[model samples]
Target: MPAVRTTFRSQNHRGRSCRDFPALTVTFNVLQLMTIAFVWLLALVPLTLMALGATMLRAVRPAAAPPGAG
Candidate 1:
């Protein structure tokens, strides 16, 4: 029989955990939210532009080909 050894140990901070680190935690959360929003908006803008361009091209381009092919 072999004894099992744990590779990870949890820190037993009695009361001064991440909750105690208010400014850094709040800043990190705010930055995370902003980054997510920025990435989402970045994706949305291009898709919206592509959709608008496709619609405009479909509306304005002629359907018939030039009169030369048989």
Candidate 2:
């Protein structure tokens, strides 16, 4: 009976440890998502700047034709 009680106790402890596993998994997934979003935002900065620069250049340039056209 004592050995059986010991086995049950050990099993109970193992189960208790696993109770927090789901919450940890969720937290890990959220962190990974945040990291991915940060990387995407970093990548977007250069493209956004390039687009803005192009728009500004077009706005500032004169609409005159090329010099070679008679």
lDDT score for candidate 1 against the true structure: 0.82
What is candidate 2's CA lDDT for residue 54?
A: 99
List the lowest-lDDT window of 10 residues for candidate 2.
1-10
Best by the lDDT measure: 1
> What TM-score does candidate 1 reach?
0.59
- The best candidate in terms of TM-score: 1
**Candidate 2 overall lDDT versus native:** 0.80
Compute the lDDT of residue 33 as modeled in candidate 1. 100
Q: After superposition, how far is residue 68 of candidate 2 from its true place, in Å?
A: 15
Per-candidate RMSD, Å? 6.4, 6.7
Q: For each candidate, how many residue pairs have backbone atoms clashing (under 3 Å)?
A: 0, 0
